[model samples]
Target: MKNVLTYACMILMLTSSFMVNAQLPSKEKQYLLDFNKSTHGEQWQNKWNLQEDPSTWYGVEIKDGHVTALKLYRNNLKGSIPDGISILSELKTLNLAFNTIDGELPEDIFLLATLTSLKLEMNKLKGSLPQDYSKMTNLEELSMFNNLLQGEIPNGIGDISNLKTLNLSSNYLEGSLPKSIEKLHKLERLELFGNKLAGAIEVDLGRLVNLKELILSYNQFQGDLPSSMATLSNLEFVQLQGNDFRSLNSLLRLQSSKLAVFDSDDEFLNMKFGANEANRTRLVDTKYEDTKRN
Candidate 1:
């Protein structure tokens, strides 16, 4: 009887040890470890103790023995993101904003099919956005503002059907706004302010029925505003200042009762409003000199 009891106690100890140590799959854990080492994890604000279980690591979320999220925003991560990040196949969110992470984005990152939100804003990242977004269909919010990215917005961006907020503001991105952007029927905020993007607003703006804020200030965009813009009933804020637009007459037919702010160059038209109009909406017809970021 004494021998049997001792053996039972040993079995319980081993079971508990396995439960504690076998939290993550070996491959995923190794990928995480590699990421940590490459990013100088030791210098992070909340450094991870490599000796401990990965479940206890900072900004890492594990579920069903798979890495599901990694949010290390403003944590002092100072290195370029390592390759093989797509190995975290179950990852849904990857937030590395406000870091010193530089270099062209790893090509593998666009392969994260399950990623819903990817926030890499306020970093030193440079290079053009990927041309193929077919694999990233599940992305809802792709915020990469305040970076050094250049080149035209990819036409393949329309492949992200689930996208809601597309903020690429405060970058060095140039060229005309892609017509494919009109396909984002779910997009709410389309901020492209403080860039060098030129050409007329050719796309049917009315197609984006859910859009609320359309900020295109401080760009090189010229020509008349698209007439379809008058049909955007959901628009609340519109900034078209600091451009070479030929006329603002197209906006006279705007039907949005929710239009709270409308800013444009006053030289194009003498926009006068009644006291009642002034109380309902704030219209600023002046040149915007400073870079506005949101």
Candidate 2:
């Protein structure tokens, strides 16, 4: 009887040890630990306390025992994002915008297939965008505006069929707009102003039937405006300043029936589209003025 009791106690101790070990090694926990240490998370506006349940952490949302979202916008998070972030297989949204986070964006973060919204805008992040953006098929909104990112826009970015709003403005990105961009059937707003991008705008832009605001001002774009743009029935604002555009007659004709906004610097209008009443009338109402020009 004494031997049996001792053996039973030993079995219980071994089972408890197994349980503890299994619970101690969580990928999500490790991700947080690495992220916190790597980014100086202790200094964040809403610092995370690793001692407590991750669900209770600030800006972190856990669903079904998995981290689903991490929104630390403008949180003063410094240092590069850790590659361990990709371990959050259930993560849907990751917004680290308006922070001091600087360094090349980790390519693995783009591999998060569950991500629907990834906003890292207004950070000091440098380095070229990844060439292979095809892994993020579930992405809906991708905004990386006002960063120090350089290099040509990746061709694979257009593979994100569900993408709606793509804003990469105010970067050092160069190269022509990829032809694959026409594949984004769901895209609405595309802002690429203040870059070094050169090359004629793709004629396939007319394929973006759902496009509402097309902001492509302040680039090195040259060549005649695509006539297909006249087909964009939903286009409300077309900001095309600071570029060497050859003509905008087709775009002006678009303004005749629909309420549209066009840049009205008389000299610029005359130089690009020629002096026409349609251009003047489109400018007179100025209510639809492209506010993003400034």
Candidate 3:
């Protein structure tokens, strides 16, 4: 009778396992299956098995039975991202940087309201940024550098008050910096270098008291540096090379005693600060000195 009881216990355990496996949510299962089919699962450096649970897939993070992050950086993921991924309502971080992923960003991508950090840098993505920034209220870090995106930065971007780092460099974006940018009081680093953005530099930048490093080199920006910028007390580095600026001498008079690296293309501008007081700031035009990609 003891042996019979042991056999029954084993059968019960096997049945429970089957039940657990079968209980996998249909939405999550379909998302993985669709992603695999769309992204050419066979070619991925880290391939996914369609038959297994998505939580077990590489670069996919699951929390509380929901996908929370999809970090597939430098995985050699080619082709466009499947639009089905917008269904991941619980996703917080979506990092697909340093890949060969090409094509326009899916419009539905803006539907991800829970997204906090979206890093798609060093890809072949095209098309202008979405117009409705209000949808991404939780976004903090948006790094989309080295893409083929064009058109003026949408004014709606200022609506994302929580943004801390905004790096849209090395794209084809044009037009003046939006005046609404002053709304980002919490912004720390703003890098808009290597683009075709023209017109005078936005004077509102001085309102960003929390700004640390502001890099706007290799663009078509014109006009004098805003006097308000000298008020920033926490600034450390400011690069404004390869542009049409009237003067940067005002920046040398910043209230921030922590200013260190201030690079530009003008030899005379460099001399203006370098010729004075101990040479504390390293003023030079290193925008094209070292051989490198964007």
The candidate that wins on TM-score is 1
Rank all candidate structures by their lDDT, best first, as comma-separated numbers.
1, 3, 2
The per-model lDDT (C-alpha) reads: 0.83, 0.79, 0.79
Task: Give the Å error, residue 113, model 1.
Answer: 0.8
Which ten contiguous residues of candidate 3 have the minimum total lDDT? 285-294
Residue-wise C-alpha lDDT for candidate 3, range 126-176, written one tens digit per residue: 989988888788989898888999999999889888899898988999999
Best by lDDT: 1
Tell me model 1's lDDT, rounded to 2 decimals.
0.83
Superposed model 1: Cα runs more than 4 Å off: 1-23, 267-294
Q: What lDDT score is found at residue 219 in candidate 3?
A: 91
In order of appearance, the predictions have TM-scores of: 0.84, 0.81, 0.83
Query: What would the per-residue lDDT of candidate 2 be over residues 173-232, giving only the tens digit for each residue?
Result: 999999889999899988887899998878487889888878787889888888887788
Backbone clashes in model 3, listed as residue pairs: none
Error of 2 at 265 (Å): 5.8
At residue 60, give the lDDT of candidate 1: 88
Among residues 3 or more apart in sequence or in different chains, the pairs in candidate 1 whose N, CA or C atoms overlap within 3 Å are none
